[model samples]
Target: MPSYKLTYFDGRALGEPIRMILTYMGLEFEDNRIDMESWTALQKEIKWGRIPVLEIDGKEMYQSRAIMRYLAKQAKLAGDNDWEAYEIDCAAGTVGDLIDLYRSMWKLSDEKTKEEWEKKLLDEFIPSFMKNWDEQAKNTGFLANGKLSWADLYLHGWVETLEVLMGKEIVNEYPNLKLGREKVHATPGIKEWLAKRPKTVY
Candidate 1:
């Protein structure tokens, strides 16, 4: 196997899912955590000035989704064929949209502003995407293609992150989504990673 080193901030954020993917594949890689202070100086060295960069055999690659897709293929977490992969990608894209909207809510400081964002989150965003995912998950134990794919891992990690941010078990409202996520959590290496990985707010 080629040498792998993942560099990111000292929190879960975008980096955790990558870590989970690597761990799930049982690939031994250096988990390099850098502090915000150091990130300033190190930012110059990062190709995109964004992290979760995976260094493979000393060559660097960027983008979280790209890295996950490449690694998922290696781990057999991708779908069985092209159409299945496309379907999985679509599902993962939907979740990514939700995550961006959710993150925007954090920027609001006022109670009124936060409440408005929360309203949009619960009343609009959650109902649409979560309902769709829940329906699919009800029929299949995973999020996409009726099988465990990288999309399932992406959704599971983001759902757990949302729970931490919202300070409640929000996904429980969608039982199938919750159940599907539980299944992902129970995957062999993932379960151990969840148990032993560093705890972070993001």
Candidate 2:
């Protein structure tokens, strides 16, 4: 088998897209999750002082987003032309914002703080993205290139992580977003991968 290794914590964080890509591709590799104590020690040992690194064929690649883009090309999910690739970039950037919003839950202590964050994200940020993606989806179900693209699955996996983190009913406001998510998640290869894959969280 082609050797690959992914290092991350339990939560989706930076490695979720990588995991989804691997699973969808049906590639077998090593998955390494670090405990708090070990995470701290390993921070000093790793080249970038970060987790969520991907080692493929013995070649180490850091930065989760970049790694995903590289592997997406290998998986033949990258778009056809530069214009199509631009859509992938935008979609990935948009998803990055959503994931950042989800991370806001970490330091929040009070229900008020959490609620405020959720309101801003769900009411404001998320709605804007929902509209944008809805328009995009109307043009083509895929994020771009009108086919299975990296951004398509990445956005799908991003929202899936959100649904798990936020709740299934959380996305009811955006039916198109929900439908788009379903289209990607229900893809033959992706659905099968999701079925047997590890359930790290919601």
Candidate 3:
């Protein structure tokens, strides 16, 4: 097995799913958490100046989704075939778009603006994602395919982040999505990780 080292901030954010994938695959890798004060000096050393850098056998790769997709393939959680993998990517990418929207809302300084944006998010953006995903989950009992895949992990993480931002139950209205997230958590490796992982606000 190739050696792996994942570097990110001390929060779950974009890093947790990668960690979960490693843990699920029973792969041992260094989980390096950087401090905010040290980031400036370390920024030059990091590829793309981004957190969640995955170092494999001393070689480095950036981008959280890329890292996850690569690891998912290694772990055989990506999908059964090329087409299945494409669907998996579609599901994960949709969740990524939702995450981007949530992050944009986080940047608003005015409470009124934030509230208005959030209203639109909850009313339209979030529901659109959930509606599509809920349908998919209903048919597959998973997010991408009829079996467990990396897309489920991405969705699980996305929902967790959304809950933190929305400050309420966001998945309740979508039963399939809610159950899909629960199923991801119930997977043995993920279940164990969640039980012992450090608690964080995000």
Candidate 4:
């Protein structure tokens, strides 16, 4: 087995999905959580100076989605075939769009601008994505392929983050998405991981 070591801050954000994928694959790995001080010190040696870097057999890999996609294939969770993989990618990309929007909204300095962004997110972007995802999830209670895939896991992580940012349970408004998330949460390995994983505020 390849030795896996994941280096990230002591938070979920981008790192948790990678951890989830590893756990779901029944793979044991080093969870290297670092603080800002440690990250600053290590930044020079890290590719692209980013967290959530996964060291596989001591070879460093960067980019969270790339890592997740690679590991998903290892776990047999990517998809069954080329078309299914493409569908999964589409679903994952949609999730990525929401994440990027949230991050952009989060970085605003002006209170008015922040509030405007929040309003747009809460009233428009989130609802639109949630509605679409809820519709898509209705087919299988999973993001794609009518079965559990990495896209479902990606959606699970982002929904949690969205709930935190919105300060409420947003998924409840979309039953299919809610059911899909629950399905992901209830997976044997993931259920165990969720029970034992560190409680980070995100």
State which candidate has the highest TM-score. 4
Note the Cα lDDT for every prediction shown. Answer: 0.85, 0.75, 0.84, 0.88
Residue pairs whose backbone atoms clash in candidate 2: 164-202
Model 3, position 59, has a per-residue lDDT of 92
- Tell me the tens digit of each residue's lDDT in model 2 across 1-202: 7799998887665666788788778878688877788898889989989778898888888987788888888787777778877878888888777777778777799999988987787678777876777777764466665567777666776565676766555545556556667777787667887687667764
lDDT tens per residue, model 4, 43-124:
9988798878999999999988888899899899989999999999999999989989998976899999999999999999
Backbone collision tally, model 4: 0
Ranked by TM-score, the better of candidates 2 and 4 is 4
The lDDT of model 4 is 0.88
Q: Model 4: clashing residue pairs?
A: none
Rank order by TM-score, top first? 4, 3, 1, 2
Q: Name the TM-score of candidate 3.
A: 0.90
lDDT (C-alpha) at residue 176 in model 1: 87
Reference-based TM-score of each model = 0.90, 0.83, 0.90, 0.94
Q: Compared with the true structure, what per-residue lDDT tens digits does model 1 show for residues 84-136?
A: 89988888888889988998887988989999999888788878988899888
Which of 1 and 4 is ahead in lDDT? 4
Question: Which parts of model 3 have CA positions greater than 4 angstroms off?
Answer: 107-111
Least well predicted 10-residue stretch by lDDT in candidate 3:
156-165
The true-versus-predicted C-alpha distance at residue 48 of model 3, in Å, is: 1.3
What is the lDDT ranking, best to worst?
A: 4, 1, 3, 2
